[model samples]
Target: MTSEIQSYNFNGASLRTLTDGAGEPWFVAKDACDILGMSNPSMAVTALDKDEVAQIDPKDYLGSENRSNQAVNIVSEPGLYKLIMRSRKPEAKEFQRWVTHEVLPQIRKTGGYIPTSESDSDEDIMARAVL
Candidate 1:
């Protein structure tokens, strides 16, 4: 089955994400970098462990208008956390929480995630993050 890009918003910043065949989450590197205020996505991705990053063609995913053969960078969960840790932006912590708390769970449960108005308690969010 082909993967689909799902966009999740954290404080108005959009993060495009997808899952591999193994069900592990991956984020579009540029999208994550943009939200984290990273100026150079390629350089930022280089700082991550080799296993945590990959190059994917747009044709592999649905909802992409890009037909170029050029491969785009994608970061696994660990890489995403690494980027989050490196970020000096004030929103980093909140963005981490949003991902671990909401985005991850929805992706795990339904294979897709996006912005939502529902709010869960910190305790609940933390619990979900642990699972």
Candidate 2:
């Protein structure tokens, strides 16, 4: 299967990503794990739900015949969030915000998401006040 992988930078770290047939984004597990300060990518991936993980050949996306046949691990959005929550690093929250507010919107902008009204409601005001 052919796939296009996109790369996003967070605090100078690269998070390589790709979308599935349904247009849902999947993040490179090693990249995310490294950003989140996880020592072992494979071990961290095992903690996520089976449905929240997948394997893909880098050759398919990179189009490099010289690349090895070893499949790379990827995580769904939910799985990424789970890893973020597990992280003890101080910058984890900032990374999460970047992913949600910036990266995801751009990725889904092609077809899947439709934004709601920009008008601020009472709840929005209250939430902002609390922050």
In order of listing, the candidates' clash counts read 0, 0
Minimum summed lDDT over a 10-residue window in model 2 is located at 109-118
Per-residue lDDT tens digits of candidate 2, residues 1-131? 23877776777898887888887789889899888888899999999999999898777774662266788889998999899888888767787776678657855775333222359786875564455
Worst 10 residues of 1 by lDDT: 111-120
Off by over 4 Å in 1: 62-69, 91-93, 100-115, 118-131
Question: Which pairs clash inside model 1?
Answer: none
- Go through the candidates in order and give the C-alpha RMSD of each one to the true structure: 6.3, 9.1
- What digit string (tens of lDDT, one per residue) describes model 1 on residues 9-125? 667777787888887889888888888778899999999999999998777773445667778889998999899888988756777777678877987997665344458776776
Error of 1 at 67 (Å): 6.7
Candidate 2: segments with Cα more than 4 A from true spot: 63-68, 100-131
**TM-score for each model:** 0.69, 0.68
lDDT accuracy of residue 87 in candidate 1 = 91
Per-residue error for 113 in candidate 2, Å, reads 10
